[model samples]
Target: MVFSWRKRKPRNGDKKVHHMELEIPRHFICPIALDLMKDPVTISSGMTYDRESIEKWLEEGNFTCPVTNQVLTNFDQIPNHSLRKMIQDWCVENRSHGVERIPTPRIPVSSAEVSEVLFSVTDSKRRLDRCECLNSVHKIKKWGLESERNRRCIVANDAAGVLAAAFDAFASDSVEKNANVLEEILYVMNWMFPLAEAQLLLGSKPSLRCMVWFLKSNDISVKQNSINVLKELTSCDQLYGERLAAIDGVIGILFKFIKDPISPLITKASLMVIYHMVSSPNEKTKAELVEMGLVSLLLESIIESEKSYCERALGVIDKLCETKQGRESAYDNALAMPVLVKKILRVSELATEYSVLAIWKLSKYEEKVLIEALQVGAFQKLLLLIQVGCSGETKEKATELLKLLNPYRPGLECIDSQDFKNIKRSF
Candidate 1:
């Protein structure tokens, strides 16, 4: 007997009908796993998509629901691939106590929708005016409400909308209004919002005040966010003497994370921040960083960390030993030279070349140090680098350093003409 197959239809007044109607939209689907886009991919099709791309999108909260166009703004919406194991362990611990999963409130808007709304405000002047008006309203309502009243008021005004506007203002090319709006947003976010939201908004500006505030916070999320902001700020010209000067104790705080046993990204970011801080223009800051035992930390990291961290730490050391004060700091601390030399001898060929250049620079100030470096086969390393025609700067510096080391040595006759010819060739 043949059986007739039919798809089940929802009956009227059925509870399951409501659940079916609330199905996730196709556009909200995550391309990677074909799920309900748990972690929304934020990049436009034009840009390169890599692990870093997904990470940045997650950081900026760019994922949206396909149907509602609302932002999936919660941290949970994005998979914390790095912390998954930790979270699983926590869940297991709670399960042992018979605790059940608790539901979290969904964010009503997405970052993309907010950007779209801001862009809809056509005239730039009018857009700025409207944003300012909205900001003032937010501030006034914030001050007026107490307890849950404030929260309800904020929700009523649409916190996500206001935040999106604030971000637009911060990214505006008009420096005057951008800086002001950024500062105000930071104040509100840090003092009022929950830690996650505050951390999300930390990317608005990388000012000195913001950096210090993030550093001083007891919140680990805030501290991590601050490390990112500091890295960005230091890379820009806005890194002034005053700001660089304040980074003296920053390295110490970062070092605390070395033993954290979780979040290698945090440790990596901390090292990057230290690298930038030490490489800044302010001598006192650089000197203080070295004095704070940065060399030892970097040395330890070199042996312990993987290639990327080791390379970055070595770059930091190179910068540290570039200047007179940095050189003296290394010399005063006896352990610096030996560790540096050892790294030079052991790492990749590129690292060896950098080490040779660093040693050449050190030789300029202290001949004895140069002799010690030479005894570690510095000359042989430099010769190999010169033969391979590594960096032009490295070659020239080595040539000059060789002249200074032994002008009357046997192979010195052709060095001056070769140096001149290389300079001419470059020109």
Candidate 2:
């Protein structure tokens, strides 16, 4: 029992008339299915089709009216109840033809309904009633993941700000038993990615304390969420300053994320945050990272991580080695010298610069380390690095390291990168 139109009335000023037979109308066939639309739904463009058919069309990258060539603002699909009833009646009338009725559609959570739920947070009497607020926010978060429309609804209705306030409320009081409330808030914000205001609020001191508290939470998901959000917060230029990064125990937690990251994402964030921390010429911060075994950790991690992580690790290492203590610690690590040399010309251009700089820093004052560098074929790597070609700055650093090593070894033979045809022997 499908249906379709065969003709329509002509436009005004035209006296033309058309007639068609309606013995068994073909108005029931869906354009997408060429048959009856079971579980039909109407889109924003006023088009109706089978729910699964239209969903598939949308999912396959179509985002316009299938018939009218109009663009759709959103993908909210509303169940066509009136059309379903008509199809059901037609199916009953055509029972002999084997047509069947489509099942009842489930009710969707509307934007207005979600707003009603979110608005409960503002109730003065229920202001202290956290469960109601938590439950409402949890519903909003759940609906947000259900579809794009729900996500837009959540954002448009300021669900992130409400959740941030709820989070801050619980975090401010910090009742030991109410950690679940914080965990729920963390989960929601992680999903939301929290807009500018919400992100700023979350980066505030009180909220940061709660986040760091969550890092110590027994729940692994909460810990990861806390790390991810911190990553997000520090990435913003405004939030990376004195309020959060300078907070006591922040670097320790970031180091902990590095020492024992639950996942690769944590490791990446830890590196990024630590780099950001050290980039501001904070000697105390760099020294703290070094004392926390940052040098050893990065040397190990560089091997474990892929290209981008390795590059960032080197960048941080270079920054840290500017301090004398950082250099000593790196020299103490058994893998430091070998790893630093191995990375040159092998890992990346940036890594090459870092490796050479580390060599200069470590070997400049430690002749024993210089002898070890020569024995490990460090001079060969630096010379090759300059020959194979790198950034002008990288070449200059490599050349400087080579010259420093030459005076010490005296007999180390190397060729000029710009004049490889002529062999220059250092005597």
Report the number of the highest-lDDT candidate. Answer: 2
- The CA lDDT at 44 in model 2 is 92
lDDT of each prediction vs. the true structure? 0.50, 0.73
- Judge candidate 2 at residue 163 and give its lDDT: 73
TM-scores of the candidates are: 0.48, 0.67
- Which digits, one per residue and each the tens of the lDDT, describe model 2 over residues 173-220? 663655766777777777676456787667777788877777777777
The CA lDDT at 407 in model 1 is 35
TM-score of 2: 0.67
What RMSD does model 2 have?
12.5
Candidate 2: regions farther than 4 A off: 1-40, 44-67, 70-77, 80-110, 122-126, 145-149, 175-178, 238-242, 260-264, 304-312, 345-410, 413-427
lDDT of 1 by residue, 1-427 (tens): 1112232445575545222122323443344334332322233332212223344455565675333445555433333333333333443455434333322222334444434433442233345664654455344335434334334334444453445344444444453445445444444443333333323333344344445545556666656555555554454433432454464455556656553424666677766666676666667766766666666666666765666666677777787787676677667665555555555435555565556566666777886775555544445545645665656776787677666656333442222222223322321
